[model samples]
Target: MICVGIDLAAEPAATAVARLDADGTTLRLRDLHLGADDDAIVAAAAGADGVGIDCAFGWPAAFVEFVSAHAAGRMPETAPTGKDGRRPLAYRRTDVEVQRRTGRWPLSVSTDRLGLTAMRCAVLLDRFARAGEHVDRAGSGRFVEVYPAASLRIWGLLEPRYKVDPDARAATLDRVLAAAAPIGTTASQRELMVRSADAFDALIAALATIAHRRGRTHPVPGHLGEIAAAEGWIALPDGGLAEVLRG
Candidate 1:
């Protein structure tokens, strides 16, 4: 099976894509690309069994509703009372759940700068829809939303300060590779991962996609199913990295 992972940025210059192929019980890094544009991402994902993207699929439903109401001059009579009351507008259900599980909040697509990147993701999703793929933000379909840091945390491979510290990032990569033994990577790929956090995240996104495909990640609770379908679910691994490699 082939799975593609994309670390999407607000623009093409910072985007990265990783293509992973699984054969029997072995996995290989078939291709890695930096500065990947939308067309390149689509090409990378073509014919793959699953495509995992490190970007929010959509904004919080309440946020969208609020924006629409404000645009139409029909704002709510009362403002949200406090942080707790405003959270539903700023953070999606999945984001809240991820924070509950990992004790760290993923970027708020509805309120953070990550929304810029999410706009790009929105276009990509539309492209997939145009190609006849049924997009399911809850991750019931081929294209699933992924959070690399959350996935790593759930799998016990996350390293503190890895995102901004080179040494920590390298250590995190080493731990991930060691945990998922029998996965093949060229020396240059390892070098790139150590040098580019985006590349490393793309690889992790692919692995998490593999876990999702194999039923190794937590499922959306039935109670939140409708909200998740609208807000997009983050696929958090429920097992160690080795379990993802098991055939």
Candidate 2:
């Protein structure tokens, strides 16, 4: 069984496909390109099972619900209200940048948004729903899953060379390599390690790690179909769960 994970980063998305065979863990393929073209991505994920994507599945309605619900009562208000009354989700304590240039923000902000956070989850779910009819390759899967692929880096699952910061990545890698030792570091450094956000390739590497550790083989019947929506962890049809099987 092969589990594929994709680290979906904007700004020229990078895809790294990993495979764990009897020979051990191997990064089978890596591609850097624009991922908005769905057909290309679908074709790329030919004969694979399971995939995890690092992007908003759709608007995180749940997150919005939280903001509308407790944010007013819990979080302190910002500067004194001007002409208009205060608003919720306004001047949040969060550091979401107000883009002066392109007026665009990273998924970090969207991920924090209600209903928006699940956008990618919706994408994977949709793909899995159509896997049976669309995924025509023999032994290829027909299901999908959406995971916060970045969580793998947070969980200490990654290869060494891909680490951008040598000292820090290496140190974190060491912790990843050995779980026995007590974490020896300051709080701020630990925080950065926890939040190291390398989107696409990083996530793909993480999925490889998951499959290597806990994947089971299942014969995938050739099928093709698609299902898309805005929601949370759903077991998509055609075996599309939360792993990057292709593209």
Candidate 3:
């Protein structure tokens, strides 16, 4: 399937892109700092089936918190998990306000293990495409997807000759694609066999952006779900990250 991963750029026009197939090996396309090139790239991957995004798609932290506190309706449709400290609800990783300051993130599997390698490949491809920023951009995005470069070893979307995360990323994103496929989207499966192509487009873009933020990038931390299981807010010391990626 033609799937894309997105690294949200705080604006639709500024987002990054990472296009790929369902298996996550074949790199259909990748880019960072898409800027004016966004439209063409989107058109190229138009038929992709799925997309993996590096940013929170539904409700940003502010809205999520408001809903949890009864200030608004739940946006994600799922509820926070882990009430007894054993099992925890895991949501997309993202930055947050902590102790009156901003820019705090819950501990998550490094990007390397959680599909950062593919992400960086997208970044490098971006440099090749537009040839501007040499480093990956690290703007506000989903907490689960973004991490320190040390956390992710890969630099761009071009498949290594190999990978470490294997099916974790493919399967996790499959959840998204399967959910969307039946609804009839702007993109479709059966045709290209690529799922979440647009979302992955942004993922590639975000990884490229992160590369720009860090001097170099690598792919590591292959077991992010496990890490989330261990460090999810429910397991944490307090009420902090409990919501995680859950609804």
Q: What is each predicted model's overall lDDT from 0 to 1?
A: 0.90, 0.36, 0.32
Q: What is the C-alpha RMSD of each candidate to the true structure, in Å?
A: 1.0, 13.7, 18.0
Q: Judged by lDDT against the true structure, how good is candidate 2?
A: 0.36
Better of 1 and 2 by TM-score: 1
Per-residue lDDT tens digits for candidate 3, residues 1-247, read 4444454443345444555432221223333234325454445445544333343222233323534766555445454444332112223322221211222343322221333433443443354336442221222111223331212222111232112333444543344343323223233322222333334445433333323222222222345333332222111111111111111
Instruction: Candidate 1: give its CA RMSD in angstroms.
Output: 1.0
Superposed Cα deviation of residue 155, candidate 2 (Å) = 4.6
Q: What would the C-alpha RMSD of candidate 3 be, to one decimal place?
A: 18.0
Compared to the true structure, candidate 1 yields what TM-score? Answer: 0.97
- Which segments of model 2 are wrong by more than 4 Å? 19-40, 62-166, 171-230, 234-247
Worst 10 residues of 1 by lDDT: 238-247
In terms of lDDT, the poorest run of 10 residues in model 3 is: 233-242
Q: For residues 135-166, what per-residue lDDT tens digits would candidate 1 score against the true structure?
A: 99999999999999998898898999898888
Give the candidate number with the greatest TM-score.
Answer: 1
TM-score of 3: 0.28
> TM-score for all predictions?
0.97, 0.40, 0.28
Question: 117 in model 2: Cα distance from truth in Å?
Answer: 9.9
Instruction: Point to the candidate with the largest lDDT.
Output: 1
In candidate 3, stretches whose alpha carbon ends up further than 4 angstroms from where it belongs are: 21-33, 36-45, 58-247
